[model samples]
Target: MSKFGFLKVAAAIPHVRIADCDYNARQITGLIRKGADRGARIILFPELSVTAYTCGDLIQQPTLLNAAEQALGYILSETSQLPVVGIVGMPITYGNALYNCAVVFAEGRIRGVVPKTYIPNYAEFYEARCFMSGEEIGFATIRMCGQETDFGRNILFNLDGVKFGVEICEDMWVPAAPSVNQAVDGAQVLFNLSASPEVIGKHNYLLSLVKSQSARTQSAYVYCSAGYGESSTDLVFAGNGIIVEGGQILQRSERFSLEEQLVVADIDTERLITSRRRTTTFAPHRPNERIIVEISLPKNPADTTLDRWIDPQPFVPGSPEEMEECGNEIVNIQTMGLAQRLEHTNCKKVVLGVSGGLDSTLALMIAVRTFDRLGLNRKGIIAVTMPGFGTSNRTYRNALALMRCLGVTSREISIRKACEQHFADIGLDPTTQSSAYENAQARERTQILMDLANLEGGLVLGTGDLSELALGWATYNGDQMSMYGLNASLPKTLIRVLMRWMAERCKDDAIRQILIDVVETPISPELLPTEEGKEFGQQTEKIIGPYELHDFFLYHFIHNGYSPAKILFVAQKAFNDRYDRGTILRWMRLFFQRFFSQQFKRSTMPDGPKVGIISLSPRGDWRMPSDANADTWMREIDRLIEEEK
Candidate 1:
């Protein structure tokens, strides 16, 4: 029904004089229509944006409060003709109480109103003097458009097939936010109407809070705060508008912009459900103190003709200075984690199988750095080059050369004869290649490393990557088993680039050469024999899609709580020049399938440090059931793809 299976949302900050309801109502109508024309299903305005947030004691005036209500009804009447869900803020009086509330409008009518639960009477804010905190968890009805409408933080409005909730400004700044409870009680998206003023270093803190809250609650948070339109007699308002999902901030408005600014983003319902399904701690609350209202959205829910641009490099820091700082911090975290593990085990030597590939190369590099930190001899690290049936001279030569150049204990063990002997012992033909044939070679290599580590009293450093573990690409008890997988937390795509970076920065010329050669080398396990007596091994990318695409899929799906539909949406945007919509959907389906099916491999994974937000280490960030069915997930993808046709 829509171009994309997504919806656009907006956060608007308008300039207006306080107590001037007529001008405020006109500005509100103009913004609502503009948002609707931009395909926004839900538009969030700042706290008390209808009239103003800095009304002070004037909020207690019956005439000012009454004008605000009349302005809300008039604005709703004008823009309600367009299909949009708008949340406007105003001061209201009901049943011996005056409250700062977010009034909800949809489908040509006022649906409900959610009053602020926590009124801040601190430092600069003094809402307590004029408003009552709606902390009591019970049902209350109020007059809206000549009818009763439910009002509470427990009230959830459903639009565009998502269950949405609301919380005011200060409600989010607390340790346990109202949205946190709402998320547990089945709220997938939380909207905050705020009137926060700007201070030195306050912007960064505000963004961090939004990111942390979104991640903690596993919900998409749209934060719309008042702009410079609010009185700046004492403090300034930057109108920090942000949209966050999971832990990543997807969209943020231009701060201090004089013109009215709107930042819009879609909240993925499917992704939130998937994440909540996987995480046991996200245990949904019982049917207690909850309200579910079905609010109708536009028939075209996915027509995202939004003026939004997707950042191609989302994981990479936006600024060069920030990127360098982040790189240093991440490297320290990684090397430190490895150092502690080695010290705890009293391991003097580390055994690693050098394949002249990204994962192994990274692990080897980290090992060298760790040894340097421990002041141990580089020779104590044994870098083995095991030539198997599928081994190529290019890879084999690089592996042995790297070990020799680094002055590590190097050993070359040809596994061709050993695999033949293994096949004979198993009573199978060596020529009969299958999963068993590939797995046999892998298991033999692991066995040799394990035995070598035991004989030398060294830790078997793992080379498998996060992507492999996510896809179950490793043979069980073969590449999957290790004493400590140094590169287990690094995604395959990132490691490839990191290895290149490390090589360029290395002081040792010999080590640098080998590392560069490894980066240029085609990725493979050398499990299958060389292609018809030709040179190289089977390419992993040929079997799986490019690691860059997979890593992109991994990040969005795991970290951002992006739905398969939304994943496909942004993937199409990010990789449009390289991959088509259909190609992305194909690999996307594979990603979900493999990620769900490979939980068993991660469940018993070796110890590894989590360098990023998403980690497959079972003991750490994720603890999904190994035997859970992927049918529901697979079905969602299938249904989306079918509808796309």
Candidate 2:
């Protein structure tokens, strides 16, 4: 069992009773065992949970303090056998003053105690009256249940390679939080035991604060707040439990819950460490006042099972409204980008090869919209449909209908005669349908488009989408070459959605109908010839792979820099219902093989406006040498294949 990388953590909201140390201890112990059973290595409790945060001035009394200390011993002993680290809140006495603190313990032993650094003194908080801030204290040992334990605000518990730091309720609210220093000193997870009271609209603010803080610190943050059992005299505690990693919330509990709330999530510690290591601006300064406690967590297999959402289409929105809005915004971006180019160049026209496929259809639509936006004549947006050996009737009609319905000047030029002549001139067999035959058609189309643009004083707008570019599906110096590619940033799955959105939203009935047909048409490059009377047979997905899987692979590969094994593991989960493991593996291997080999194609790609995170613009987002080897990547894939066998 390999034990590294991922860390399973929990945020526990135990039902508390004010001043009833025994009952609180039992509640906290129960949640700890539950978290341990669920494979949570680190479980966190709300602030002052041992005696309850609402205990008020009872915190100053000796009897209550003694009871809280005894309850701590009870919890430590009860959770001794569990292979987990528990962080619970209580009040401690060092000298003549009492302080609010979180006790970190594991295996029947108290590892350390982290005192709250910022005591909230204003606005419903009077911690200054009963408790002292931990700022003045560096490190000390206090007797708890006859055991002298480590205590300080700067203590970082190192459990099985996972470094965790602690902060109290108000610590996160301040501008310069103690978590900032702790993270800078090498803490991957920041655990905050909060007792924040619920107001009208504080949840949103608190949620945003956690998100921004996690992003800034580049660490996983687990926050658990006091729940319904506290005193409700002046305020009501809503029990908001949140587990965030890298600024993304993994799990959140319902507010005002009467029962104990426990939210468990697997945080990717490896990702956090990798991000911190890569960021040049993250400078860590070692503080001499901090102590690192080395503890051991149970050596178990790293759990790849995820309880969070693995969105199938990470680039596209999930909701209908958001999808529509996204489509609108994408179109606006594409139109605006082209509009800027046209205005700056002051070109006479825009020329593009309309293949009657999704890519060309989208590009043609953008050209029309851009011309409209710039108040240029629609005839200047020349839409040319180049018929080849594989042009299907369905797509052919849709393309012509779309061009005519949109009122753009359209023309047709067949490549069969030109390709045949070229093959004869090259001494290649015109009867044989090989790559030469297909590529001949593609190159001929490019030649015609370029020459037309030059003659008409226009720019030849490229019509290939990002997925095709990523997989290197385009023929070199043929469809791959363009003056300005508009859809280069969008993936195949997104192009489908955008086409449908346009169809439904278009006010022109004829154009709307034509676009609907275009959305339903199968994606094809139309390079190979069709049967005697059948439709075009060169389906793009059938030759390469499903666009959905390819796009998924591209997003995780380029955006997150995930390894091949990790990408396959998550893809199996995301597409379990749709695709089998063998099919996924095959396509994933194909994706990597093509992506690495195709860098040469992307290395010299034309300029395109980037609309999303996953862009292959060589000069802008991605820059790679054309000769980078793929041996290590392929060897990993081979290992995955062997494992499957």
Of the candidates shown, which would achieve the greatest TM-score relative to the real structure?
2
Q: What RMSD does each model have against the real structure?
A: 4.4, 2.3
Per-residue lDDT for 1-645 in model 1, tens only?
A: 233434466787777678788788898889888787777888898898877988888888888887887888788779867888999898878789898899988866878889999989889877788889888735788886576788776788877567888999999998778888888878788899999998898888988899999998898899999886678889888878898878777788899888887787665556677878888978945655677888876564334454456665555556656656656666777789889998999999999898877788788778888899999999989998888878888888888888787778888787888888988898887677888888998888899999999999999999898888878889899989999987777777667666766777789898898889888988998888787767776999888887777888878767766667777778777888998887887888898898888888899999988886678898887789998898977898998789769
Models 1 onward score TM values of 0.82, 0.94
lDDT of candidate 2 over 1-645, digit per residue (tens): 112266888999998889999999999999998887777888999999999999888889999999999999899889998888999999999888889999999999899988899999998999999999999777888778777788888799898888889999899999989999999888999999999998998999999999988999999999999998899999999998998988988899999888888898888787787778767688656565688999996643333356556778878888899887788889899989998898788885999988777889999999988888888899998889988878888888888888888888898988889988899999998678888888889999999999999989999999988998999998899989999989899998998888888888899998888888888888887777777866658788888889999999998877767788878877887999999888888998999899889988898888888987678988877888788888898898889888888
lDDT of candidate model 2 versus the reference: 0.87
* lDDT of candidate 1 at residue 146, scale 0 to 100: 72
Kindly provide the TM-score of model 2 when superposed on the true structure, using C-alpha atoms: 0.94
Best by lDDT: 2
lDDT, residue 4, model 1: 43
